[model samples]
Target chain A: MAVEVVYRSSRDLERLFMDKAEADRHDKMLELAEALASALQNAAPTLSEKQADDLGIFMARHRELFARAFKNNPEALAELPALEKN
Target chain B: MAVEVVYRSSRDLERLFMDKAEADRHDKMLELAEALASALQNAAPTLSEKQADDLGIFMARHRELFARAFKNNPEALAELPALEKN
Candidate 1:
């Protein structure tokens, strides 16, 4: 077998990246997601950990639109860009 | 005073906007800020209300950078654009 090198995101060892930058990015995203989840749980104790984690990941994935909403263009929230199917 | 028609953001009665769109945007930003403040307070009870509000506004204003960080580019947090002086 040929030797292959791949960078694994520390956040999720299951996934591997061809480039270090990509792995770093993924790790960063996971960190932000955790922060968001923690915040959500803190503010609303009624929410389960799973709910908070799911919401956190969702927000992190669509954060650009969220940024626009926070940036004084709430209408941007309604305008979601088309996503590519894997 | 000249007869000037201005729009006011319901979020903050003290501020007035020259355009309706601008007012709407400001209102939206305030709404987001409030949500963020609530989250901050919820997740971290040690933070005072004032501190939460201040941080919320700061995050809301610089949401683009925050979004980038959430989108797997945490380095974006270090790349802040210069703000215009009023």
Candidate 2:
């Protein structure tokens, strides 16, 4: 079986931010996550195991980040940078 | 049937950022997303409809913002603000 994977790296972050226009890495991540959900809302039935896994990774990462981007947040996001191992 | 809803507002964004701690608003969002995915990774088969819908809305919004928060982003996240309406 294909191994479960995780995304990482500055480049991964850069890829995640690929669609962002500018000055929006924070906001766009949420939006892209939304789009993924929209896709899932319509795609749950047909998504493959691997596809589902991919989406799962995508969504979890999306929410994880969303919850921690507050202005009053306890630590710098730089410490918890995006993954690169995937 | 419950409608396919969207989230909005500064408060929603604030809620989203709730787990963020202090900062970076920029990086924590991604982490939160990952956590959500971890949850999904474990709970997909049993998630309730409303629960799924809520999760969908949450995910979409997350992706949307993520893709837009780049340093060179065109618009500020403040402009797109999270949805407040249920």
lDDT of 2 by residue, A1-86 (tens): 87654333332455433334432544444454444444454434444454445554454344444334422232333344354223
Instruction: Give model 2's TM-score for chain A to 2 decimal places.
Output: 0.28
The best candidate by DockQ is 1
TM-scores, all models, native as reference: 0.53, 0.22
Spell out the clash pairs found in candidate 1.
Answer: A42-B42, A42-B43, A43-B42
Off by over 4 Å in 2: A1-39, A42-86, B1-23, B45-86
Candidate number with greatest TM-score: 1
Candidate 2 local lDDT, residue A66: 36
CAPRI quality level assigned to candidate 1 from its DockQ score: incorrect
Clashes of each: 3, 84
After superposition of all CA atoms, the RMSD between model 2 and the true structure is 17.7
Tens digit per residue, CA lDDT, model 2, B1-86: 87553333332454433344433443444444444444453445445454445544444344444444322232433444344344
Number of the top-ranking candidate, with lDDT as the measure = 1
Cα displacement (angstroms), candidate 2, residue B7, comes to 29
